[model samples]
Target: MRLTMLRGPLLVAPIALLTLIPLLVVLGSFLHPQPEVWAHLSEYVLPEVINNTLILMLGVGCGVLLLGVPLAWFTAVCEFPGRRFFSWALMLPLAMPAYVLAFVQVGLLDFTGPVQTLIRDIGGDSSWFPRIRSIGGVVLVLSLAFYPYVYLLARNAFLTQGKRALEAAQMLGLSRAQGFWQVALPMARPWLIGGLTLALMETLADFGTVAIFNFDTFTTAIYKSWFSLFNLPAASQLASLLVIFVLVLVGMEHWARGARHYHSRIVAAERIQLKRWHQIAVIALCSAVLLIAFVIPVIQLLVWAKSILQEDLDSRYLGFTLRSMMISILAASLVSLLALLLVFIARRFNSRATRWMVRLATLGYAVPGSVLAVGVFLPIAWLDNLLIPIAQSMGFATFQVLKGSVAVMLLALAARFMAVAFQPMDSTMQRISRNQEDAARSLGLNQRQLLWRLHLPMLRGGMLTALLMCFVDVMKEMPITLMTRPFGWDTLAVRVFEMTSEGMWANAALPSLMIVLTGLIPVVLLVIQSENKQD
Candidate 1:
């Protein structure tokens, strides 16, 4: 018993500490002020980055609410032409990364692209269309990519309470719109805010889409500071500022949701009846959202990919594909195992410390990839410096030890995505019965035996789910992989970034399509799972 107790803290402490060091390192940058770099940043970069980031967040927040809430409400409660299909299909856009959509829209809609070119060819003016490289374009793409977060949560909230609220409102002589505004919408406030919080966090953490548009944000500033200016301290300082934004958002979410049991009865409400024109209007709205978000981007990607398939189908792509799959698999396997271990420890120990450990370990998902990349690399680079002198004394001529290696990339990825793997496993762990655990203990099963015989088998589904989620995320991840990957270790995302950066839209399409297809696996599985649960 004493040995088992010792094991929990011994195992958990190191993992939690490892998870925390990078964040601490980034936060500590303020102590070591880089005056020269800070002067240049304050003069040339900070103003625009701050202004653009704030505007981007505000725009994305409104855009998602506008797009997500109505779609969620209609699909949840109203009987429209395609309500059933739209409920799940609206989530299809989650598979399309914002950067992928950004480049696709830019490629097709830019001044010299086909859309404006055709307009010009037909003796029409081309300057009137909105530029696809502006702040508005970034907001639109990110909103389409992230609104599904709000939709998923808001729909669930409405499904549970929307119809009941409407019926109660009607009894009180309120109209349907009034019921939605005064009753149902307010009741779903927690879900709406929760979903909005997630969307905004993604917006704040975004690096790729903003980069593609050349729209300046803290994430892009961090990238340029490190890679362009070769100043790690400035990058760390910028990342710390970004971390402040994330922390504030997270704090607001917590305070807003404090002790609120908004979820009432889990009753399935009856679908609301709509007039003919209202039904038609709702159908058209939903169809337009789905069409723009998922259908058009997919078709555009297919068109570009088909054009490049003949020329781009070479050994070079095989290397890119294989490298991407290999690293994704390795990171997924590693993070899933660690996440499972943390879940097991939390369940087995059930202490305040263990809970805090779990929280710290899982906090990585809120930290952006660019921030994590800078935070993680600095410490590893410092350690490399420490070891290089020791190695030289030992007659070894080593310039770099751990810097620029796959291990650093894996570590950053594990930190950035720990929550992704932990959440599902923790939920599954919660469902496990205490009585079963006690009974097994009563039957003289040791801790190891208990885990090996019972817990592992039961957690297989969750483990696989975690693996798939992590795999897809790592495959789609850009900032960390781009910053941390060793030379000559380009993945599909890096390939897309390279091609898109150079304005080679056709070259980027194949990899973007691959990533979208990979991302769809989890979304499709989620839809199937939701259907099963509903059934």
Candidate 2:
């Protein structure tokens, strides 16, 4: 019994410590002073970073709510035209990363791009077009890319609320609109807030979209400080500020959702049906969103890929594809395994300390990849510096260790994505009956046997879901891979960044399309899962 009890903590502590280290390293920048850089940033750059970050967050928050909530409500509550198709179609945008969308939009809509050229050919001046590299453009692109988070959560919330609550509101002398405003909206508040929080976190952590737009934010600042200026301290400091911003947003989300129970009586009830014009309006709304968010962007990428296929399809491109898949598979497997172990331990132990440790381990997902890269790099570099001299003294000349290695990149990926794996595993575990374990134990099964025979088999679906999601996320990841990958270790994301940087949008399209295709696996799985739930 004692040995069994001790096992959980022993298994959990090391992973928890590993997860916390990067955050601690980033936060430790508060103690160190970067006088000259700090002074210059504080007076000029810091305010702009703060202002832009806030504006981006606010803009994305509003944009997501505007796009996500209404669509979620329509799909969940009303029987509109194309309701069946839009139910899954609305989620397609989740596969499109904000950065890829940014490039595609810019390539299509910029002053030098086809749209403006066509307008110019038709006699429109340059001033007739809105700039595609501004704050407004960033917000639109990010919103289109990220609103699915809000839509998914809000749709689930509305579905879970069922028809009874809305009926009750209608019986209370309230109109459908009034019921939605007073009851449905309030009940969905927690979910809406949760979704908004996720969108804002992604926005805050964004490096590629903002960088492509040349819009300065905390994430951009962190990247520039470390890579451009070669100032680790300044980068760390900027990362610290970004972390604080994330924490504050998380805290605000918690406070906004405080002590609120949004549960409705679960009953099988008929959904609200819309009339002809209302149905048409709902269909049009959903179609417009889908077209703008997923269809157009994907079509543009396909066209670009078609244009460059013969020239870009070669050994080097294949190498990049293989490298990306290899790293993503490896990282996804590691993160999913770790998440399973952490969750299993937490369930078996069921202690406050163990639970909190698990929670802390999962918090890495909230930290931006850029910040995590900086946090991870500093310690690994220091360790390499310490070990290199010792190796030299032992007659091993020119031996280098951790810095600029694939291991560091994998570690950073694991830290950034473990939460993605954990959430699904945790939710699945909650649905599992504890009696199964007790039954196994009565049959003389030990913990290991019980897990292998019972839990592992039952957890197959969840584990795969977690693994695929992590794989896709790692494939789309930019900042961590950019900062930590070894020499000549360029992933597809790096290829996209490089080509886009050099204004090679056609070349960037192939890899960008590959990423989107890879990402589609999880999004398709998500749609299937949601449909299964509905069924």
Candidate 3:
């Protein structure tokens, strides 16, 4: 038994090391102070970057809460038209990347775009409209993109809490409004905060959206520090700061969620009957959000894609699509494999040390991709410097080996998405009966045989779900691929970034639409899963 426990942890050692490399590299940047870069950044860059990040987080925090909590409450508890459809339809926005939405909104709503042009042709004053290129616009775009995180969790929280909590409050002589504010809302606080945390993390990690809007967040700062300024240390230092901010957010969320569980009775609570006008209002709000966030953006993408289809559709795009799929498949497979191993080790060992190792391995998902890009790149670059000389001595003329290869990108992607794959597999693995495992062992089956025959067969559903989720995530990923891909290895995301950088909105649209379509697959599956659980 002792040897088995030791073996499980030993298997997890490499996974933990992989996760730690980026973190340790980023944190270690402080040791080598680039006095010139710090001097310039301290005066001009850090202030705006930190301020914008804080403001963005604050604005998005408020925006998602206002949008998500109400939508969750209405769909989960209130009786309204289209409630059943809206329950899943609202999650459709998850398929749209914030950057894609950012560019589409800017393309349509900017002063020179068709919307303002139409307004001008009709003799309306366009000067009164707020600029979509500003900080506020970025906040709005991100809020719309990420609110579904809160809605999903908060809706589940409300569904499980049900109207039982409200009835209890009413029994104590409180009205519906007061009951919701004082009892039901507070009961769902942990979930609400959890969802808010996820939205904020996405907001913080955002590079493409902020890049499109010309907003100076930590992510963009990190990117500029590396690519524009050609300062790796500066980039690593900025990434470290962002890592600090993410850690703070994670710590706060953990503290907020401490030892709290407010479970109401599981019986189905009757939906609240709303007045006639109220239903109309509810329907209007839900429709507006859906139209603005998902429907309108998709429609506009089709229009833009159509305009540039002839010029842009070629073997180039075929390459882009193939490269995106190839890398996504490779990265997803690697992440799923690591996640499965971690799940198995954690389950088999069931020790505190093993759990800690699993947690460390999965923590990479909390770190932003831009940060991971820097962290992964620096260590690999160092390794390349060491290996190139040895290779040259062996008569192998290689200037660089691992620095910009697909293998390095796979490593970074695997680190960034380990948790996305882990959560589903872990949940599925927990449902496997222990008695089956014991029976397999009692039949003199070795551990490898048992896992191959019993666990692998049972975990097929989870494995597919994990693989699909990670594949789509990698396909949509930008910073890691943008920073780490080999020469001429452009994915669809990189294509979008390149076109948007040149102010070619129409050219960006086809790739954006393709990405959105690919993204919808996993989301639809999630909706089905949620519906099954509800039933």
Off by over 4 Å in 3: 1-6, 264-266, 396-398, 439-446
TM-score of each: 0.96, 0.96, 0.97
By lDDT: ranked, best first = 3, 1, 2
What ranking emerges by TM-score with the best candidate at the front? 3, 2, 1
**Candidates 1 and 3: which is better by lDDT?**
3
Candidate 1 lDDT over 106-141, as tens digits, reads 888899888899999897798877888788889999
lDDT, model 1, position 484: 97
Which tens-of-lDDT digit does each residue in 402-458 have in candidate 3? Answer: 888998898889899999999999999999989989999999989899989999998
Clashing residue pairs in candidate 2 are none
Poorest stretch of ten by lDDT in candidate 2:
260-269
Scored by lDDT, model 3 comes in at 0.91
